[model samples]
Target: MTISTEMLWLIIGCAIVTWLPRILPFIFVRALTLPDVVLRWLGYIPVCILSALVFESLLDTSGPIVSFHWSKVLTFVPTLAVALLTKSLSLTVITGVVVMALVRFML
Candidate 1:
């Protein structure tokens, strides 16, 4: 595929736009020593984000009453246990994927 000058510039512009927002925050934050309160609060961000993502995935939003998939709930049990017992991201993810795959297959 031949890319024209305009397409190349468009690609460059998009890259800069995407990269700046992600990188700029780290660049600014890295230099400053955040206070203990801020640091403690920042720690909750990942768990909050993860919970949001998991709930969004497990719930069927057809009617907006928050219908949850039983299979996902079942899958979450072992995954959460693995996360708590092992305290490992990789193992937890692997367990989740395997459990979900098995649950889907069985269903």
Candidate 2:
């Protein structure tokens, strides 16, 4: 469907509002002194968010299963172990997604 001019303007305005908060940090990061604790937490936020998302997607469902899905457990348990051992978020997520997809396709 074609968007109306008013709707287009609203979307543009919303985009600007959404972007300013994210942009403001980079714009001001150079001019400020940051607390070490706050900076460390900020560094961790993305990994925490990613793990939360992966956990929910892997483990949360509307109904119960007879036994835990072994393949999902197989995929994610190793993913977490590797992530912790190596301290690599990207590798962990990629392995989890790939292994789960492979197991799903195989069975």
Candidate 3:
């Protein structure tokens, strides 16, 4: 396959468009001092987003009634325990993945 100049420029443009929004905020915020309340609230954003994602995956809401995904719930038990016990993100993720793999393998 041959690459066209127009397609190359398009790719470069797309890269800049995708990168600007992510990089611009940090560049602009570097010099500014955010208020303590704002900083505290920002810290909760990651936890809230993570919780939302985890809970969404754990429950099945496609039908009329919401139901729990037993396999995920089973995986979650050890994962949550590891997270609380170690307070290590890397270890918690490893535990979750390994536990889920085992659950899938067993069932």
Candidate 4:
């Protein structure tokens, strides 16, 4: 089947987008050696970023204020505690959802 020009452009775009990030890390990492501490910290980057984003998103009951709506606070506190205590993603999420739902429905 003959592909249209749009399809060709899309394929090229996908290839470039996929390659850019992959090539960048290789180029930069090879050009300069990162410190051991930097590398160690880099490992936690995804976790740190995810935690900050989740906390930021969840904290807003009605904008960014220190308000305890109970459900949101209940949900996230146990969630983070379980995650840190158990170091298990599945347990953390399951516990959080269950607690949140129970609190919401119960109250």
Task: Identify the leading candidate in terms of TM-score.
Answer: 1
Ranking by TM-score: 1, 3, 4, 2
Q: Write the per-residue lDDT of candidate 2 for residues 3-103, one digit (tens) a residue.
A: 99999999999999999998999999899999999999999999899888866666646568544456777787878888898899798888888888988
> Which ranges of candidate 2 are over 4 A from the true structure?
56-107
Per lDDT, the best of the predicted structures is: 3
lDDT of 1 by residue, 1-107 (tens): 79999999999999999999989979989899999999999999999998999888889878758688889999999999999999999999999999999999999
- Candidate 4 per-residue lDDT over residues 22-96, each given as its tens digit: 799988898898999999999999989988887766665685766545578767788889989999989988998
As a TM-score, model 1 comes out at 0.64
TM-score of 3: 0.62
In model 1, pairs of residues that clash are: none
lDDT to native, each model: 0.94, 0.83, 0.95, 0.85
Error of 3 at 17 (Å): 6.2
Model 2 accuracy (lDDT, Cα): 0.83
How high is each candidate's TM-score? 0.64, 0.49, 0.62, 0.52
Residue 105, candidate 3: how far off, in angstroms? 2.5
Better of 2 and 4 by TM-score: 4
TM-score winner between candidates 3 and 4: 3
RMSD of 2: 5.2
